[model samples]
Each structure stands twice: as C-alpha cells, then as structure tokens.
Target chain A: MGLVPRVVVDVMPKPEILDPQGKAVLGALPRLGFSGVTEVRQGKRFELQVEGEVTEAVLADVHRMAEMLLSNPVIENFEVRVEETA
Target chain B: MGLVPRVVVDVMPKPEILDPQGKAVLGALPRLGFSGVTEVRQGKRFELQVEGEVTEAVLADVHRMAEMLLSNPVIENFEVRVEETA
Candidate 1:
C-alpha cells in the first residue's frame, strides 16, 4: 500500500501558562503508585497526511496551518516537522 | 539552569476509531484556504519531568504508566520515549 507523506505538529502550552489538564495528570500519578515523575505537561499532537512530496513549500504551508489553526499562538507554541513518507 | 530528564508519551486514537476532533480540523482546513492535506489525526502528547537520571528501570516504569494511565488500550495506542536529559 502506498502511504502519503505525513507531517506532525506538536502544540505545547507556553512555559508560563497554566496547564490544568497536565496538573490533574500529575496529581493522579502518585496516587496510582507511579513515582519519579516530578512534573507533567500535556499538549496536542496532529498528524497530517499530505497528497504529494514534502517539499519546502509544503512545510511552509504546514507551518502556516499550525500557526493559524492547529495552535493558539498566544498561549501555545507549535512545532511542525515531516514525520514520514512513502 | 539545570534541566531534568524528560520523557514523552504520545497517545493516539486507534485508526479504526472515529476522531471527531480530527474530523473537525480536516473540515476546516480547506475553508481556510489550505489544501493538499488529505487527512488529519489529533492526539495527545505528554511531557514528564523526572526527578533523577533516566535509567532502564525508569523507562520500564514509564512504559507501565503509559499502558495503565496514559492511554486507553482498547481504543488508543501509546508510545513512550525519553526525549531529553540533563
């Protein structure tokens, strides 16, 4: 089977921003008997399957998508990268 | 500044499962004038900061944590990896 190129965009909350969801997870870990984890921050991961070769233009478009829709620039930072191709 | 070891855990919905959030993003992309992206999948990324060195035992514990707390094995798949260390 032919797989299309895939791009991954990760959106994480800004360091100074409060991550309530991550805090909840952190609170639950030790209760579940898991230790050594001192902090937890949760974010979103997006996998985009594109129709053609992943060129510079494609990556630039992906970056635009990340900034415009996948993440909120005011509260989050996003990273875009080509994950795989076929 | 001293940086601690960090482990990343990614939890994605099983391919066969319907992802309404991803669907919403896919539908919005074209309306925003971004094309060529045929599909989109949204998932969760977790960054865990550990208290000390990331050893084999730490990784094993993280794997167990991923299986038990980070993902729903019945409908989601999870990956755990050590991202960076200090």
Candidate 2:
C-alpha cells in the first residue's frame, strides 16, 4: 500500500432508465462473434486517493460527494467503499 | 440468483497514461467542498448478464470481448469476473 488509502465510488444508471450505450454494445456483441450475453449496463467507476487514513467520517464525506457530484440521484445510484491497496 | 449470471468488466486507463476526465473531476472536487483527495482516476464498469451458467469458457470469452471492444488495449486494461447475484 502507498502512503494514502483509496476509495472507490461506482455510479450506475437506475434500472428503469434506458442505457443506449449498453444497448449499442449488446447489439455489437453478436456481430463481433460474441454471444450468450443478454444484457449490458455501463457505469462509471471512480478511484480516489485519500491523503490520510480512510475513516468513517471520510467515508461519509465520500458518500456525500457521490450523491452531490458523482451521480445524479434522479437517474442513478452510487455506491462508495474502500478499495484495498496491494 | 436469477436465471442468468452477471459478469463484471472494469476498464481503466493505464497508470502511465493521462486521464483528463479524472483530472477535471479532481479539479472540481475542492470547488465543491470535497477535500482530502489527492488523486482521482475515472474508469468504466460494465455489467453483462449471461444467458446460462458462468463457466471458465464464458469468462474467457468475456475477456476477449473486453480486449476487442470494451477497452482500448493500447491505453487501457480490463478485468473480467463473475458478479455474484443477490
């Protein structure tokens, strides 16, 4: 591990929302000779390197960050967690 | 678990490459009152629903998909794994 710990935030579209990018990929799959994939959902992943240790307070702040900027609550859901460093 | 299994593919830019999007997010963070984050790297996460059981062969195919379409091998690296369903 480096001197700083890392936090991972994943922002994904809501299940009800349509993901055109994913649909495009799904359509292109079979054309590329890849099959058996029924659905594909594309999302964003963010890795943040924190200056200090990952405490509950920092995690809470990260959650708030996810809600306020990383994701649009109306159409997306966000998950925040600590990513173990190698 | 549902009738089908889900595979997760994460595509991230190589560490040596410049990530302008992530840099933009990092620049906007402090303006949004988010601090303590030294660095940020943004990537893509893909959730793929497979029609049948997720075997090693399926995983291999997913890896190939990641290499051929999901990511640009010249600048990005991808990881493919089965996502456990609830």
> In model 2, which regions exceed 4 Å deviation?
A1-4, B1-4
Looking at model 2 chain A, report the run of 10 residues with the lowest lDDT sum.
Answer: A1-10
Question: What digit string (tens of lDDT, one per residue) describes model 2 on residues B1-86?
Answer: 34446899989999999999999989998999989999989999999998778999999999999999999999998889876776
Q: Who wins the TM-score comparison?
A: 2
The residue pairs in collision within model 2 are: none
Clashing pairs in model 1?
A: none
lDDT of each residue in A1-86, candidate 1, tens digit only: 77656899999999899999999999998899998888899999999888878889999999999999999999999999876556
Task: Give the residue spans of candidate 1 off by over 4 A.
Answer: A1-4, B1-3
Fnat for each predicted structure, in order: 0.88, 0.84
Candidate 2 docking class: high
Candidate 1 chain A: minimum summed lDDT over ten consecutive residues — where?
A77-86
